[model samples]
Target chain A: MTVSKDDKWTEKKISRREMLKLTGVGMAGVAIGASGLGGVMKAMGYELLEDDSTTAQNKVNFYGPHQSGIVTPVQTHIYFASLNVLLTSKQELQELFKQWTPLVVRLMNGETMVEATTNTRVPTGDTGEAAGLDAANLSITVGIGPSLFDKLAMQHLKPTALQDLPHFPKDQLQQEWTGGDLCIQACADDPQVAFHAVRNLVRAASGKVEIKWSQAGFNSFPAKGGTPRNLFAFKDGTGNPTDVQELKKAVWVDNGWLKDGSYLVARKIQMHLETWDRTSLKDQEATFGRHRDSGAPLGKTQEFDAFDVEEKDSNGEYLMPDTSHTHLARKSGVQMLRRSYSYASGVMSNTGAHDAGLLFISFQKDPAQFIAVQNSLGRMDKLNEYITHRGSAVFACFPGVQKGSYLGEALFNAL
Target chain B: MKYKSLLSVLVAGGVLMAGCGDTEEAKKEDKPATEQAEPAKEVDLSAELAAYKQFALEQMDQFLMETEKFVNFVKAGDMEGAKATYAPARMYFERSEPIAESFGDLDPRIDGRLADIQEEGKGEEEWTGYHKLEHALWVENTTAGYEAVADQLLADAKELHALVQTVEVTPDLMITGAVDLLNEVSTSKITGEEEIYSHTDLYDFKANIEGAEKIFDILRTKLEEKDAALVTTLDEKFKAVDDLLAKHATADGGYVSYEALTEDDTKALAAAVNQLGEPLSQMGIILE
Candidate 1:
């Protein structure tokens, strides 16, 4: 991990672009040899950089039974954009998806969207901002919104449960950050890498799509990985399922073109910091039904202590208040894999409150799981007082790719 | 968070200085580096601060008068008048809320929401503020037990008026406050949730915009001298939002009912707020 800039192993591991530059190989030769280069180099016993703790340098596998970003370890940064499809015809939309697949693959492999072309008069194939950088563990997850079905005239193919979320009590949802025809969630260890992934994809879809709304979010990485905190300084995503089997039960969809996929529920919850900041510690703790410092459930000393909504104190009062966020969420018994992150655009210009909140993202096998939990929290959750659900949307995430197939290939084929 | 940021900056500066030391040492061994960039000019903000102080005081004076009127309406048991006057009265407070909020416990006492009190597990006796008056006027539909709270509100408004005269209106406050006003609208007011009980968020929204506009007005000359293009963009954006807001204006100049607004109207206003906010946020950095 501490390998110096001039290390021998670093020098030996020549990138494909570097290899082309050194050998003066033409584009055809490079393209033909692209898939086999790693295998060929391995067979020739050429030792490159060791597969170790270089998380930022390592390339994540884009093709799998399920998308990488869904259940993969949460990256430090994310640039999630929901784009409205400009193309009306199914053919054009499918073509855009087809064009995006190879680019997504190249980016995830830590390569530029396309190999650099020697045409000075024309624009470069790749944007070149990420030219000198690694892939930074980039993972791009594409999703289809409810409106996309109308555009493609594929309503029959839509998932049975794929629909807009119900408006909850106290929801002041803004339209701009609400819904879109399609969404791309890009996550990476480096912020620039995550942003670059979305930028290139959006650029590639120039005429076919436009950004409906986007939110950039981040999670601070402690030396040891653990749950991150929301803008309210409370540990969020602590209850998320980490086991693969548990994730499969709670997240992966089982039918249609979305098989092995998941449903993404994104909510832009604006935390009322001005009011929350004025709140007493006792009230704040009561609102959460957990200890702020340790993130432990009331009447428990550890963060992971099983939450008992019915537990009582010496005064015969409920230790975990029924209205507390944890109590209501726990009582609902609906499980989803939460992968939320905090975001702050800046201090809102209208009010002095910090324009910050959790970009609450959750994935489940069905949207009902998320809805059930939200419904449980709708009218009674004490945390509701300090937060507003300002944005809401649901997207049907596509299943992962096979070795040669591109993203959402099954959906394209079905259409 | 501020301490952490400062520490990080110091650490980064140390690293940069160390790198420069090494490079300069090498350069001295070869030849002295030529053509260093000129230092940036520093601008004085005393005049701006003085101007903002005057603006804050004037705003507070009007806010005091309005709060007294609201209190008087509540005392007279004029429920409809109180309801109608509620949001407009909040305008003065909203315009200079950042400065008002600068005084610990003042804003909460005067403009705190019902959730603020209820969340704290306090009963009506403990909940003392405009929101208390609001709940009484709207929810209870009577001002029976709010007499004491009314007097207290009037007293607090006067306190705010006196306290504002001595306020130090720094450039950072104006810059941050301007952006904060926009964020306030985007976060809660635009959603019509800011004045949820009364549905008078339109008034708060207008006042916040006016407050932000006032800051831009005071700093316009300075900002223009620095970045004329940004000032021009802000001017167009401000006009765009104001033009849209004008459609909702009543005969009395206050906004129409918050419930009267359509989703499209809110959307249009929010877009304009963002359009203005993006460039307005740059003012602070420029001033710095």
Candidate 2:
């Protein structure tokens, strides 16, 4: 259960990228290891700086009936789908970004506007153009690539080569997609929306691009949304952070490439429990390793309060069962920043039923770290027996603040 | 008795997410990470992007093909072609239904329309005979009953065909209109006047265990193609479940038994179902 040196990076507050920018380039990752930002830069192809410049955006959305569908029978009204878009890229890297900026503004529902930063309060309105924005429930994310290359490499505004791909350059011309592209984090509210968006997107890509294969479903999953979000009764992500708990940054702007800005995005295909109700509450608690009364691990009462493994009796043995939810979560060394929502089956009758269950979501710095948390939930967790895995997909987003500069998206062809 | 039948086929075949909206929804819950690169001294930048592009294209290509193949079966009337194809289809579904449950926010109208097919059994000819199958899918969500109704419809269609050729009767003009029913179905989400079902309704949030059991039984007995095509699809599906099981299993093993897994994980008391149930169902078909 011991974490690697990468563990400490996962615990920082300002985010290693932002810190790197503020601390000065080259000096970034100076204290870290070979496997640290510097080494990862060599293997991956990125640059890192601890500066004060604006960053990429993180988008998380909720698509389902406008209201709750778990316990109420309100016809699962207000059909809507929530999406979480993440953009991880470095700005000041791309050359012909106009074609890309318009698309980002349209998708994120924000407009290019103007205003002036003041001496006191937070700034109102941007400094460039002027207009209104409409990102309904959509959120576009942007994150600074944290790779060692990104930490130390100079901005890849120079020419680069992609001789590997047709129509690409061989001179190492910068901005040929050394970062990422919209396709890397592209998606839609519906299948047609997605298809159409991607069609327009690839047409926009005039150069060579390299996309991560693991994110094959970057445009799929959620398989369905909106009214379908709450047909069943189980609440998903009930324990997730709500509107900036202890983890949120103090200020977040939504303007220009950031109007209607975002936080982070999480995705999961939670198993439904239509047939799970047959068991007793006691049994159910045992399955989740947490108690139903307070949503805490067995032996603990408070919901959000941390589980006290040391709360033992005279015998000096563990208080909460080691196999309990909180115990295992702690032992597994992963935290659930989860935020779940339910979806309803489009059709249901007296006998046959429709689909319904939780769409569990969470966010963290490294997928591997979050993975550790999810793994604990997998092992000996009380909920395991009653639930089964269905679908899975992953994405890497950037902290977006500039138009057309999505993480990895801009560099999709460059690297 | 809750007669058992876990015969669940992928509704509307299997739709693939073709663009960005696909990523935005799921993107909401993840922590964004920026990947970096090495200085160009030794690494071949062009070679790298090239290799990555090939891998991406290949995977996307396979997924699209698989998705299209599944949907075409239904629209082309092949879903009912093999009775046994239904079982493996159910197995794929039984494992998926729970996760599909997230569509808790669906409009009952969509499901209601489909439910009417079974309850009233009157919309069969009224919904434009030419593309009755398409209507059964888009308007009614009758995917679960296609097999049950195909036989009856086949007989009816044959009789209609004879009457037309012999001049005993005129062909139902409506049948001719079934022309682009599939294209229509595909565009239903876009052009439909009313807000019926959304992408969320597509999820199987809950398990229709009873429905799945019924379908699997039939599929086990009659699916004809035991060859590579059938085996491959079935294998990929099972692999999906196996991967999930491995990811979610408890550390000590014996994670959740099939029994535990079957019960609604979200509830404290799910009902019991019969071990086996009758597969006989009165289903409908399209004339076109």
Candidate 3:
């Protein structure tokens, strides 16, 4: 998978205008060999590194101050994969990242992982499932897990805050779903595009890594478009940190090799739909501490209307039940950016119940923010009866890649 | 049965009325009437469904005995012995899963994987089943802490066996049960996810196929009467799947470890199961 350092295209810098023109021509059924596409990409990579072009249809940039998927407005779908590293050395791991950087750019550009090949004898470089689809706002974020540090013998470089989460009460975590060496959180408006990004990336790293466990999830927005409702029929992500300053304070780390990067906490929470469906509508609303139709705090009329968690009614009873999910979470007084997707894989074969839930993902400066909120939910959150934490993982997502440099370059430089 | 008989009588009356019309028109109507009457000779499925229930009970009987032996091995802290008996004991339950699943919570308690309980939003402490012991034997490589789980597994198996006797097997259960059994194979068993640590998925795979095949066998005579070509297709597809599975069989009547199969072998098996599944899924509609 190594690209030769002395390749002619690696040295040739092309202008964005010229590169777009050439790629546009190529897109119109021009026959380019696999190597030819690689060369063209190397040249285009240098030009597109500085700023994201507004011209590309529904595209997200590969290079930025922070990773794309973290605060990139929630997409319609996510294909999150946790991978186990098979590589033995840190140098080999570094090489794999270098090999992936340009490919990531190509996918976000709505281009195939590699150009279409005329040779039918070999499997296509790209799986070609997402062919002819636009970029669909695809964003790929990569992160390193705690186990990867030990595997590569670079424990000293591991972040102090990045470690396995403590077992929360009632967490029924499974080994297969828990930890991973690394993670790729690919999200896009189109399900196939999100899936294609992860598929091509994993395929490229074939022998070097394998998916430990992966889940595909989605969020369906209303026609008017607002916070998408989870499977529980409550508008989620309503309380996420939205403003730039709040995002900086809560999400992006400000120091060390991880400056501007964030810690990603992923919890695979399975929501029992059958039980929830049996409950009354009023109970469902009380369980979430919000109106089921308006997504507002209890006793409020609008989804974003402010209300104190401790607000009491005229009768001196708390308006928002203290045991409610939102009340407990707000009492923690910490916030993390929630970018979650709901999943409905199929029914449980034995009981004929739905096998569905939320792929709960959050980004925080330190994982303690998420931990504090989860601890606040604790054993008493009314929502616990309908949900279980099945899988959990935390990863130190790298700061965004810079032009002429690859992913995780800061960490390697520190070493 | 009453509705069908009434429908046939109405058709016979319509045919008699046509006999009062012109001779050529009556002759034309007579040929169509006989064609309609052919289906009126419908095979009664009650006896076949009853036979299916009996088969389910027999499987449950064998399941209890095998589970007891497996439980005893675990209680004695015999890792090798428990591991050896684990998948074979599970085979009986897999073969009659549609019947066992009908009983409330028993299927999950006896056969639930760790993920299954978690998906049900249950706590880990509530996970008392065969896979719990399977994890202890294979992953932990010690049955020392699993004596209680072993006892619970046997008790659940016994309860399931007892409950099977009360299950009323309708034609719908048999028809959909056959399709469900095949689906169980293609979805999880084919991926070797059911027995993650033990890698004895092939045993469960074969058992599910046999269970589905048993239902098909009982319904074969009636199905052939309705669609002979479909029955032929199903027979050929089932044989194709069986032939592929036979290559992986061991002399001890067990199967090769699921992990031992190559990528190509797994794909080939998946393809065969899918081929069989297409025709098998139609059995319900065809029977209706």
Candidate 4:
């Protein structure tokens, strides 16, 4: 526990083959031999990364110009946790982020979080739930909330665009789940891997932060891989900004330490499944103004056909109802990158209805972009009948990692 | 009628004798039967249905009376009075909404939110309900050009009363209604956004709880027979929630503003509702 925190880089960087030669650890007996040599390296703040070429398909690069999770192709599962900073000092927060960087790398590379110790007296460094699992293309994204600045006395460093969201007309936000000081979003094709990332991260920050709230979500991709439907069974992310150029314009921030970072707006929108299940198929289609089965715009043949919001029907009515969700969202004209997933938490304790809805996540250059769309969604969208906005938050995601430097290192050094 | 009753009794006796014949072999073998056969007793649910209908009709009558008062206040341009009357009037309708919603068109005309009929920016002409009146009283702060809607609201309230009289109530409907009432409140009212402009969601919340409680009260005797423990706990939970809500009642017996309740208060209410909801859901299965 009293080991030096920063000594690995000073020592020689040994290749895995040399390390294995120096200390006989092979693929078959790797688990048994982990405690002997790997434990020592780990205690010295180094975890050996073997060249396992088979894992090439299962790993996402941890160091990039932009974080991997945001614009990376969406994963099948997510574990999003918003934490309340328990540490009072900025240095503590900075050190925690530093410690997390390599662990994230190891996890994404499908390597053990820490050396496997044969010692049974002490708690295992890793939970070992994902022991035999591959990485499954895991990505972990970290972010800081608006309240974090005040806590660290770094309010002057706060992004101008990072503010608490304004209350919409129909918003009924729950206090317990609404706000946090920091957030971590972990995504993976495998649920266990996703949960493992968040679990170990939380474990690593044992005394520095406490989970304010967390939600587990999942998505089912078509065999050919296409847009997935939300709990409402409508194709979501249909109109998201997908191109890197479009992302730069609409998602990635362009100034300060957050130049390559983006703002995340998370909303826990609860779908009233019981009520929705009772509604007629026609009424359901009319509510979203899309054919539920095809997910096409009203009167349109293709799902991706541009919405003709103003086109008139034979009856002189708008082809899509003006109060429809897509029309209003399209009217806002504020494009953001959506990476939402559906979630179901069994029956709501009070209502006896399915506690399910979209864990709505969107990335943008500024929170104002999301606010504009939400303002447009204010009381008039017919979709409001079957859904309720129960929780909301805003966070400024840290810029991508550079090798040898940790997350948010630029911002901390600037100060 | 006497002759028919006698004939049915004879037929029932014949079936009972035939049922006894199956046991003759066992008696001849001197094998002791595990238990004696009990006569099948008929449970008439018509009395419960009639009582539930009467209760719904009575609640509608009160709803119509309140709507009349609400409309009068709107017509006189007494904005404050109309606003005060708004949520209280909604209580009667919300309490009997399961039956009121049986009339599909009437429910929308009477309780539809502004979102139901119009676009985001445009004023809605087709919308007419408690919410439309709410918007006029709270958001617009005037009742001008709302006279026709007020008139129509009263007409609908009366129609709902008449319509409810014709609705067929069954044990199953009562059970479903009890569960749905809780769902309705938890989904919308508990958040205190159902009456967004007026902040009068507490009235609706209390009404919905009481409405669900009414069905429980009607069926408590039967439920006690099936599962006494569940009935006992549900009764206690309802009382606890009602006691919590009682703290927010104004001097005139209307609820306090939804905004006035503290976060702790809201959480306590939610916790209580959840406690009652679990057992309330079990009612459907047990009654079946």
Going through the candidates in order, their DockQ values are 0.01, 0.01, 0.01, 0.01
Find the candidate with the highest TM-score and give its number.
Answer: 3
Best by lDDT: 3
Cα TM-score per model: 0.54, 0.32, 0.58, 0.56
Question: What is the TM-score, restricted to chain A, for candidate 2?
Answer: 0.43
* Cα lDDT tens digits for candidate 1, B45-81: 8887788788888888888888888899899989988
lDDT for each residue of candidate 1 in A9-97, tens digit (9 for 90 to 100):
33464555454453344322222122211212222222222221234466787777988798888888999999988678887776677
Output per-candidate TM-scores for chain A, rounded to 2 decimals. 0.86, 0.43, 0.90, 0.90
| CAPRI class assigned to model 2 | incorrect
Taken in order, the candidates have interface RMSDs of: 19.3, 31.1, 20.1, 23.2
Measured with C-alpha atoms, the lDDT of residue A188 in candidate 3 is: 97
Rank by lDDT (best first): 3, 4, 1, 2
TM-score of chain B of each: 0.83, 0.21, 0.84, 0.81
- Worst 10-residue lDDT window for candidate 2 chain A reads A161-170
Docking class of 4: incorrect
- Misplaced by over 4 Å in model 3 are A1-12, A15-54, B1-288
Per-residue lDDT tens digits for candidate 3, residues A1-415, read 1223545544466554555576556532322243222333433432233234557799988887888999887889999999989679998898788778878887888888765654332346688999889999999999999999999999999989989999999999998789999999999999999999998898766547778899999999999989999999999999899899999999999999999999999999999999999999999999999999989999999999998988999999889999999999999999999999999989969889898999999999999999999999999899999998999999999999876677888999998
